[model samples]
Target: MKAAIIGAGPAGLAAAEVLSEAGVAVTVLDRMPSPARKLLMAGRGGLNLTHTEPLDLFLSRYGAARARLEPAVRAFPPEAIRTWCGGLGQETFAGSSGRVFPRAMKAAPLLRAWLARLGERKVTLLSRHAWAGWDAAGGLLFNRPDPEPLVLRPDATLLALGGASWPRLGSDGGWAPLLAARGVALAPFAPANSGILIPWSAHLRDRFAGTPLKRIALSFGGRTVRGEAVITAAGLEGGAVYALSAAIRDAVAAEGEAVVTLDLRPDMTADEVARRVAAPRRGQSLSNHLRRHLALPPAVIGLLREGEAPPETAIKGLKLRVTGVAGLERAISSAGGIRLEELDEHYAFRRLPGVFAAGEMLDWEAPTGGHLLTACFATGRAAARGMLRAMVG
Candidate 1:
């Protein structure tokens, strides 16, 4: 059997490996000049391969999509990914935070090893071939830079085109319209793991645009995420903000904006903060008092003074109005794609037989810290296995 895996990101690559191993002649195609552009970019800050947390707790990171992704993830869990990396000559180790990374601390080495293995398996990788849906004869149409588009008739096709984020690195969400035209159920694309946009005053934006608020807790919609957030020219972003992005995005969608409560010092109680603030000032200025007693940084003090300084009890509850979410181009990842209802348990499109999908193209969203990459790899393997089953049956 022959299989064509479109979009050479983690999902497509993983699918290619699985199908090729199953004795299928596989070809991986990508629109970019090469492949795995996003993967390479993700490693700029030390590639986070996966998380070492317990299966149940780790699975919870995917939020609403946990149920849909459970099967694939369970089949190829974090341990499997680590083992796979080891097989590629890239041993992985978990960090203090439980995030896993290859020993090389880069993506290029792993990708190079993977691509070499693919070459050994005789899996064809065709770059600069952009899929343009199908033609009249049910042949896959791809538009190259040249005049005539290329058409291919493969036994099975897997569309792993990613979500609408990091367009320059590929995954521009251009596949959504094509899939929608084919009567495939699709959910509207929205930014996931994106920063929030707040109408910050000019002073705050100018002074603290790149400032980091370390050890902070952000609360929204009765949920709280504790991590560091950075002040951007437009708003705030970081691990914590990305964790709560779904709730904040939904709240902003339902309403005009969402109010996020920022806890500058989550380690201390409000009463403790009050007591500290109320301590003997010794004729110190209010700012100095805050700095000395509360140990609040300049950025925090400036942020507090941006509007009205709340009482000590309410200090931990400083609210910021989130006007919008960062655009897809700026988002780390995107949410909403081909609705899962359109597919069977195997991830094959029921409306289009012989076609399967995996990765961010599917309607699912997960935060950073390796969840996204793990799901991509898992789903890719699952889709390939589904194709193998179908071919055998």
Candidate 2:
């Protein structure tokens, strides 16, 4: 059977691999000039293929969609990802943070190897083909630049168009309107792993923009995440900020703003901080005392000055008033998409049979590190299995 996989991101590529292995003729189509642009970008920062955390904790990271995505993830868990990477001759290693990466620490090698494997399987990759939804006759139509549009009818189709983030890279969320018109239920897209826009003063913004706050703990809505965050000109961005993004994003949506508490010295206890602050000034200025005793940098001290003077314990709970989340353009991933209920157990659309979806295009969001990539691979494989079952059975 002939299968068409759209978007060519992690999800679509994973699905293509599965379908091709099942003796199906797979053609992976993408709008861009090449495939897996985002994946290449992700590899720049060391491609986090998956996490080495325990299964239960790893599954819990998907939040409410855990139950919906669990089956696929379980069927092809983190171990499977490492095995698959090994199959591609990419040795996998877990960092101290439990994030798995290829020994090469780059995406190019893995991607090149993967493409070679796909090529060996005769899985066709047709780039620069922009999907323009279905034609009047229910045939798939694509917008080719040469003015002559192309149309085809495959036995099955998988739309893994990704989410609204990194639109310039290909996943522009342009497919949402098309799918919605087909009576598919959709959740409005929102920034998932994105920064929060805090209205910092001109001085801080000018001086501290791009400053990295290391060994910090951020808390919001009773959840605490410890990691590093960078002070962007727009606001806060990085792993810690991303971990709190969902909570802060929801609060901002519901209440117009959200307050997050940042612990500059997360390794120290509240009492320890209080003791350090209570030490004699010894003719030192407040800034000097903070720097000397607490070892806080000038940027962190600037943040402290933004708030009212409080007890030493309060220093550990410095509040940041977040205005809104960064837009999808700046987001690493996106939350919300085709709602889970709209799809069946096989990741096939209930309203549109013979069609399947996977990856960030679905209504699930997870923190960065490796969860996102893991789920993408899992769902993509699952969607292909679904398609194969439908075709065979």
Candidate 3:
């Protein structure tokens, strides 16, 4: 049997591996000149493969889509991902944050090894082939630089085109209208794992545009995440802010803005902060007092002063108004795609037979630190299995 996968990303490539191993001739096509550009870029700061947290806690990171992705994740969980990496001669290690990474800590090595293995299995990779819906004869149409588009007719096809984020790296959500025209249900794409836009004062924007607020905790919508964030010229970005992005984004959509409280000293209690703030200033400026007593950095002090709260209360709960989220071009991933209800358990479109989808193309969002990649790999494998079953039956 021949199978065509219209994407060369983690999901499409993962599916290709599964189908090829099952004796299916798989052809992996991509719009980019090379495959897995986003994966390589993401690895610049250590390629996080998966998380080692307990299964339940890990699954909860997916939020509303937990139930839909549970089966695939359970079947090909973090351990399996590690095993797969090892099979490619890339050993894996878990960091202090419970995030997994290849021993090389770079995606290029892992991707290179993966592609070599796929090549050995006779999986064909056609670059610069952008899927453009279907031809008159129901064949897959791919637009190329040439005048005529390329056409393919495989026994089954998997649409792993990613959501509309990082368009430069190949997942521009261009496939949305194509599927929507076919009468498939879809949710409008939105930013996921994106930074929050805060209108910083001219002083803060000019002086601390790139400053890092380290060892801070951010709270929004009753949830708190402890990590670090950087002050951008226009807003805040980084791990801590990204964890609460979805809540903040939705709140902003409904209320025009969202307030996020930053705990400058997460390790200390409110009373401890108050006590420190009450300590004698000894003629030192308030910034010096905060620096000496609370150990808050300059950026944190600037941020605290931006709010109307006094130093004592602001030290523990300095609120910042988030007016918007970073656009899809800057988002780490995207939320909302083909709605989950449009796909059956097999990952195949209920209305478009023999055509399946996996990865970010589905309407699910998760925080950083490995949740995104894990689901992509898991669902890709699951979709391949479903396609195989469909072919047999």
Candidate 4:
């Protein structure tokens, strides 16, 4: 079988790895100058390949998409990822947070080795090939952003274009429109694992802008995330904020604004906080007292001051305004893409036979913590398996 895999991110490359190993001659076409721009970007932060945790707990991270994606995940879970990294000569270790990393602790070295392996496997790569939808008579077409066109045909095709985030590095969610044009049902792409845009007060912005809220807990709806948040010039952007981004995004879209609560001190109890605040202080400034008693970072202080002083009763539960979510271009990942209903168990589009989709291109959003890459790799392999199954008969 011959395979043409599009977008050389984790999913596309994973598909190429699986199909080629299955004796399928594969050609991976990418719009980027090189493969895995997002993967390379991820590696900059120590290349968290997957998480080191039990299967069930880890699989639950996908939330609503869990059942639909379970089989693939079970087949290619985090342990499999660590094993694969070992095969690539990058030894792995689990972080204190349970996120796995390469011993090299860098994405570049691992990627360079992975690319070398892909080359050893004889995967033909065509870089700078912008996919221009399909040509008449049903074949692949390419537009190099020039006058001429490039065309290719294979026994099967897999489209692993990433979500709309990071358009500058490609995966511009442009594939959504193209696939929709080809009669594929697509979910509206919304930013996920992204920061929420808030109306920061001028004083707050000036004082705490670019500050980090350390050891903080953010609450929205009924859930709480314990991590650090960074106060950006525009608003708040950080891991904890991103963990709640999907809920916040939908809430703001539905209600125009969402109120999120930040537990300025998640580790301590409100009673503990209040008790500390009640302590006698001789001519100490409020900032110094708060700083001394609670150790609240300047960012948390600014956050607390965003609204009227919480009555001492409300000091522990302070609300922050999230006006909107960061734009897709600024998001870390996206929430919406090809709806799962459009694909069968094998991840092949029901409407377009011989065409498979995987990775963030599919309509699923997971928090960071290696769940994103796990699904991408799993779906890529699943799509390849689907194509292989179809060809065998």
Candidate 5:
């Protein structure tokens, strides 16, 4: 059987591996000149493949989509991902944060090994082939630099076009219109794991922009995440801010703005902070006092003084108003795609049989630290298995 997988990303390539191993002739197409551009970009800062957290806690990261994605994740979990990486001759290690990364800490090596393996399996990879809906004859259409679009009719197809984030890296949500025209149900795409926009004072914006706020805790909507965030000219971005981004985004949508409380010294209690700040200043400036007594950095001190809260309250919980979230172009990933209800248990579209989808194109969102990548790999494998079953039956 011949299978065509669109989007040469983590999901599409993963599905190609599964189908080719099952003796299916798989052809993977991508709009970009090369495959896995986003993956390589993610590798710039240690490629996090998966998380080693307990299964229940890890699954809870998906939030509303947990039930829908649990099966695939359970079948092929983090351990499996590590094993697959090892098979490619890339040993894996878990960081202190429980995030897994290849020993080389770069995606290029893993991807190179993976592509070589796929090539050995006879999987055909066609680059610069952008999917352009379908023809009246029910054949897939792809646009190229040439005048005429390329058309193909594979026995089965998997659409793994990623979500509408990092468009420059190839996932531009261009496929949304194509699927919607076919009467497929879709959810509006929104930014996920994105930075929050805060109206920083001119002083902070000019002086502290690009400063890193390390060892901090951010709390919003009853959720607290301990990590580090970097101060941008417009607002904050980093793992800590990203963890609470979804909740903050939803709150901003419901309300005019969302308030995130930042704990500058997360290791200390409210009383401890109050006691430290109450220490005799001895004519030292407040900033110097904070620096000397509380060990707070200049950025944190600036943030604390930005709000109207008292020193004690500010140290324990300084509230910042989040005006909005970064757009898809700046987001690490995207939320909302083909809603899960449109697909059956097999990941195949109920209305468009033989055409399956997996990856960020699905209506689910998760934080950073490997949940996103792990789900992409899991769903791709699951969708491939479903396609194989459909072909047999």
Candidate 6:
């Protein structure tokens, strides 16, 4: 069987590997001059491969689409990913937060090794060929540099063009209009794993514009996460905010604004915080008191002052209103895409047969720190299996 996989990111790569292993001839295609530009960017901060938590808890990260996603995840899990990496000669280690990373801890090395193995397995890699819509027979059409176009007739084709977030890296929702033109229903892509915009006082913005808020607690819609966040002149960014991004995005869409409260110190209770603040302050200023008493970081202190300078007791529990969320251009990943209703359990387009979709291109969103990559890999493998089954049947 011959297969063509589009978008050479994690999903497409995984699909290629699975099909090749199953003795199916595979050709992977990418529009970019290089494959997996987003993957390489994800690795800039150590390339989180997967999480190390228990299966149930880790799976919970997928949220509303857990039922749809669990099957694929069970098929190719974190352990499977780790094993795959090990085979690529990249050993993985779990960080303090239980997130997994390769020993090399970089995307380039792993991608290079992976491409080498794919070459060894005889999977063809086609780069610098942008995929146009399918032909009348649903055959893949490509636009090469300064050429008319090339038509590829594969036994099966998988579209993993990714969601719209970083258009520069090539997963621009550019595929949406193409698929929609073919009657494929697609949800409007919105930003996920992105920051929110909170108007900060000019005074505070000047001091803490680019500061990091370490070890704080952020709460939204009954969900709480303990992580570090960075304060930008425009708003909040970092792991903590991204954790609550989905909820924040939904809430913002529903209402004009959303209010998210930060414990700023979840490790301490109201009483504890009150006690800490009540500590005798003889000569030190309020800023000094907060800095020395609560051991608040300079950024947090500056942020608190920016919003409102409350009485010592009032500082125990603070409230902040979030006006809006960051835009798609600044988001790490996008949320909405082709809904699961468009595809069957096999990740194959129910209406468009002999074609499959995988990865961020599918309708599901998760935070950073491996959830994104994990789901992409799992769905790609599942889609490949679907293609293999179709070929045999």
Give the whole-model CA lDDT for all candidates, comma-separated: 0.92, 0.92, 0.94, 0.86, 0.93, 0.88
Give stretches of model 4 more than 4 Å off. 145-147, 311-315
What is the per-residue lDDT of model 6 for residues 41-99, given as tens digits with 9 covering 90 to 100? Answer: 98989999899889898889888989999999998899999999999999999999989
* Tens digits of lDDT, candidate 2, 224-273: 99999999898899999998898899999999999899888989988899
- The C-alpha TM-scores of every prediction are 0.97, 0.97, 0.98, 0.96, 0.98, 0.96
Model 6: how far is 282 from its true place, Å?
Answer: 1.9
Model 4, span 11-67: residue lDDT tens: 998998889888889999998898899888887878777898889999899999999
Q: Which sections of candidate 1 miss by over 4 Å?
A: 311-314
Q: Lowest-lDDT window of 10 residues in candidate 2?
A: 305-314
Clash total of candidate 1:
0
Model 5: per-residue Cα lDDT over 1-393, one tens digit each? 999999899999999999999999999999899999999999998999999999999999999999999999999999999999999999999999999999999999999999999999999999999998889999999998789999989989999999999999999998998889889989999999999999999999999999999899999989899999999998999999999899899899999898999888999888888888889999998889999988988888889877778654688889888999999999999998899999988899999978999999999999999999999999999999998998878
**What is the TM-score (0 to 1) of candidate 1?**
0.97
- C-alpha-based local distance difference test score of model 6: 0.88
Full-model lDDT, candidate 1: 0.92
Q: Going through the candidates in order, what is the number of backbone clashes in each?
A: 0, 0, 0, 0, 0, 0
lDDT of 3 by residue, 1-393 (tens): 999999999999999999999999999999999999999998997999999999999999998899999999999999999999999999999999999999998999999999999999999999999999999999999998889899999999999999999999999999988998999999999999999999889999999999998899999999999999999997999999999999999999999998999888999998988888999999999999989998877888888878878865887888888899999999999999999999999999999989999999999999998999999999999999998998878
